[model samples]
Target: MRFVRYGAVGQEQPAVLDADGELRDLSGVVPDLAGGVLADLPRINPQSLPRVPGNPRIGPPVGRVGKLVCIGLNYSDHAAELGVDPPDDPVVFLKATSAIGGPNDPVIMPRGAQKVDWEVELGIVIGQRAKYVTEAQAPRQVAGYTIVNDVSERALQLERSGQWTKGKSCDSFAPMGPWLVTPDEVGDVHALDLSVDVNDARMQSGNTDRMVFTVPAIVSYLSELMTLHPGDVIATGTPPGVGMGHRPPRFLKEGDEMVLKISGLGEQRVTVRAEG
Candidate 1:
């Protein structure tokens, strides 16, 4: 099933995509899609619910996200483009939950920011608690998948003297959703294609097959280091073609537009703007 949250930010109501691809109100069936609720999504006939009147705003599929964990350079080709070798272990980092925003929301550029970049990635939404789980047991802990635009500020990320989180945790930096596609709905997660475009120009195109770390591998590995709770989101790294990898290097600016898509998870079209 494809679950969603539709309405205004903070007022988003739970919804599910019906067979006809219409949004069916799930507010009467369940609460917001988050935490323990994700582990046991009710089995319902979407057609029986009220159809959403029109195209309301779609918020991040998962609510009250506990953590936005990310894996860096998980794609071998991405590591190659950056002139580095893939790490033996997943490169883990954390993006502040405050950065979470609706997929279509505007991305705000930080003051004095330079080298803002775009990374199209596949996001894994955790369903159940996991700790020291093996790869074989990891599948049961996953609820679904979503698209993530891991926006970054290279200056603060690589030039400044701090971790990547500083450049990554700015509000509106983590645009996710459109739908939270269940594993059963998104068969073969490793084969999904993902890409990103800036202002209608294709900038990044790659597949999950190129990932140095697979989905279950990432989940299992992360569980070993920290407890994975329901509603935690893991951004499996981006593919090659980031603005930073361009010949002359490209970066986002005010008024820019971004389009991100992953095979069955759905798409995100966002506008870029300067912060007040």
Candidate 2:
């Protein structure tokens, strides 16, 4: 089941698409898509609300995102492409909770920004509170998965020479979800194919089959460091072919369009514009 949050801020509704892909309101049944309510997703009949006419403004499925954890270079080829060595353990980082944004929304390039790059990743949303969860028990803790564009400002990230958070946590930096594809629908998160495109040209592409640290390993490792709360997200990391890996480093400019997709999940097209 693909669950979503839509409409204006105060009036937003928790919704789900039925078997025929028709939107049905879930707000009356479940309060919000956050806090991992889908863990024991209650059986609600589909005919409960008015039929949705068309696609509405899709917001990030999880409301009240706590902290966003990210893994860097989990993909082997991606590490090699950037001329960096794959670490023995997960390379972890954080994006400010304020960086969250809608998946198909415009990506505003920060002013005075030189290199705003794009990374396509498989994002994981934790459903249960997990601490010291073993690899064997990791799957039981995850709520579902979604397609994510880890849109970054390279200069803010690298040129500053501080934590990656500087460039990674710009407002509207985290664009997540057209749908949160449940775990059962996305078997083996480490083996999916993910890709990104700029305009009509293919830019970055690869399969998750080559991740240095598997999904379960990452979740287990992270849990040991900090409590993994429901509504918190983890970007499983991107495959090879990011603009940063290029010699000249192809980056985004105003008016550019981005299309990103993950298997079994949906796709989103984002247009780049100068931040107002």
| RMSD (CA, Å), each prediction | 0.8, 1.5
TM-score, each model?
0.98, 0.95
Give Cα distance to truth, residue 28, candidate 1, Å.
0.7
By lDDT, the best candidate is 1
Give the per-residue Cα lDDT of candidate 1 at 216.
95
lDDT of 1 by residue, 1-276 (tens): 999998898888899999989999998988889888999987899989999997789899999999899999999999999999999989999999999999999999989887999999999999999999999999999999999899999999999897999999998999999899999989999999998989899999999999999999999999999999999999999999999999999999999999999998888999988888
lDDT of 2 by residue, 1-276 (tens): 677778764356788877777888887788988776756654666666667667788888788888899999899999899888999989899998887877888888888987999999999988899999999999988888988788889888988879999999888888988788788778877778888999888998999889898888999999999999988899989988788887777999899999999988888789998988
Clashing pairs in 2: none
Clashing pairs in 1: none
Supply every candidate's count of residue pairs whose N, Cα or C atoms clash at under 3 angstroms. 0, 0
Residue 203 of model 2, lDDT score = 90
Report lDDT per candidate: 0.93, 0.85
